[model samples]
Target: MIKSIGTDLVKLERIKEIGIEKFAERILSPKESVVFKTITNELRKLTFLAGRFAAKEALFKCFKKGDLTANYKDFEILNDENGAPYIESKYTKELISHITITHTEEFAIAFIVLEYAEYK
Candidate 1:
């Protein structure tokens, strides 16, 4: 069964203005921070930061009503060998989550779907 859905859109320029290092330190998990630092292109770096920011916002919206407490550092977004993004969090063990992130030159957008399976 589906539990919740969340979506967020962020402006690339806004992320750019915030400064990548500061924003990454504030928002990205330690693992994500490493990836952010490895990117060589300026625009790609901004887009990457914006995408992660939007994704985290979307994930927070998914469980904001629950008793769970979340912070940007609590969740890490990781990619598989094929570059498929997935959430790695101790807080979401019982819930299954799917994330999709995309970006244009001006904006980065993300959508998260959370679900839980019924057990007999």
Candidate 2:
């Protein structure tokens, strides 16, 4: 069952001026490291990191039961074999049902569906 949906858009140019590597270091996971490594443009890097930040916040909002301020490092979004993003957390895996993520040049969006499943 689809519990909730959230989406966000970020300005590509805004991130560029700030430096992409800094933004990537702050947001992107170890798996996403490669994505930024090859992206030469600073703005594209910022756009990517901004999108990821938004995706993490969106997933947190959709979580069934938890304090909004709770530290959730495990909740960081990671790319799958196909480059699709998914939440990786022992807590979320047990509480969440499923999720989907998408992005464009100007924005990145993520939808989280809460569910009851065994934690892998």
Candidate 3:
């Protein structure tokens, strides 16, 4: 059963101002970095980051982190073979029920569904 669900939206321009390279390195995985490298406009890059940030926040909402602080890198956004973005959390791998992310030129969004599963 779905234990938790979350969704977030972010502005493209706001993320663009933060510098794509810096934000990607800090928040994205190595594979995600490669994808970000292909973006030409800062707005697009921010849009990608915003989607990823939202996904992470959604993941956090899925679990019981309590007072535990979360690092952005703790959950990396990765692309599937079909080039769809998905969540990859090494530490809390078992609790996720499902995740989805979407982005547009003006905004990015993500949703996460959590299940009551064991985490290693």
Candidate 4:
């Protein structure tokens, strides 16, 4: 069953102004940071950073993080062999998550769907 849905939009220019390297380190998990460092193109790297930020923000909207606070690092996103992005985190063991991210010349947008299932 569908548990929740969330979406987030981010301006690419805003990401640029903040400096991709600084933003990437702040939001990207250690594994993500390693892949990000290998990218040779500035635009692709920026887009990657923006997409990750938007994705984390969207995922944050899917559930509450309790009274402690929200930590972007809690959600880790990675791409598969086909270049499809997927979520990897200890927090999502019982939930199924679907996400899609897109970027234009000026913005990055992400949509997320969270689902719950029972073992048969």
Candidate 5:
């Protein structure tokens, strides 16, 4: 069964001005941090951070309003060998999540859908 849907968009330029290291520390999980550190190209780094930030924001919106307990680091967005992104977090482990992230030179956008098993 579908539980919730959320979407967010982030400005690439704004993230670029925030400084990669600072932004990564504020949002990236331990494993994500390692990936961020390994990125050598500045554009790739900015897009990576922006995608994660937007994804987390979108996921947070999936919860009921006034639920602000989730921090950016709590939701880790990681890519598989094929470069498909997936969510890894205790909060979302039981729920199936689907995410689509896209970016241009100016903006990054993400859409998230949460689902749970249906019992008959």
Candidate 6:
């Protein structure tokens, strides 16, 4: 069953001015940072960071107040063998989360749908 839906948009130019390095440290999980570091292209890295930031922001909107207290690092966005993005959140392991991310040259946007099993 669906519990909540959340979406966020971020401007790439704002992230560029802020510097991906600074925001990456603030927003990315350790595992995510490692992956971010592997991208050699600066534009790709910036887009990646923006998408992740928007993703986490969207994920944050999925919860009710007091559902949990979480920082950006607690939400790890990862890919499957098929390269489909997913949210890996230890705090919400019992709940299913679907994520989609996309970017234009100027902006990055992400959406998340939080779902629950019948048990929840």
Q: Which clashing pairs does model 1 show?
A: none
lDDT of 4 by residue, 23-119 (tens): 9989999889989999999999999999999999888888855444658787888999998899987666788888999999889999998898562
Ranking by lDDT: 5, 6, 4, 1, 3, 2
RMSD of each candidate relative to the true structure:
1.7, 3.7, 3.2, 1.6, 1.6, 1.6
Q: Could you tell which candidate, 2 or 3, scores higher by TM-score?
A: 3
| TM-scores for the candidates | 0.92, 0.65, 0.76, 0.93, 0.93, 0.93
Candidate 6, residues 1-120, lDDT tens digits: the string is 898899999999998888779989889999998899899999999999999999998988888563676889999998889988998877678887889999999999999988886645
> What does candidate 5 score in Cα RMSD to the true structure?
1.6
Q: Identify the runs in model 2 with alpha carbons over 4 angstroms from their true place.
A: 1-6, 41-44, 68-73, 118-120
Winner by TM-score between candidate 5 and candidate 1: 5
Clashes of each: 0, 2, 0, 0, 0, 0
lDDT digits (tens) for residues 1-120 of candidate 1: 788899999998887787878888899988998888899998888888899999989988888765666788898988989999999988777888889999999999999998884521
Better-scoring candidate (lDDT), 1 or 5: 5
Model 3 agreement with the true structure over 1-120: per-residue lDDT tens digits: 567787777776766677667767777777777778899976666777888888877776666574477677777777779977667766456575467888877777888777767541
What lDDT would candidate 5 get against the real structure? 0.91
lDDT of 2 by residue, 1-120 (tens): 444555544555556666677766766667677766888875566656776777776766765345645443445676679866677766564565455656677766666666554432
Q: State candidate 2's TM-score.
A: 0.65
Candidate 1: C-alpha RMSD after superposition: 1.7
Local distance difference test, each candidate: 0.87, 0.63, 0.73, 0.87, 0.91, 0.89
| Candidate 3 local Cα displacement, residue 43, angstroms | 4.9
Q: Predictions ranked by TM-score, top down?
A: 5, 6, 4, 1, 3, 2
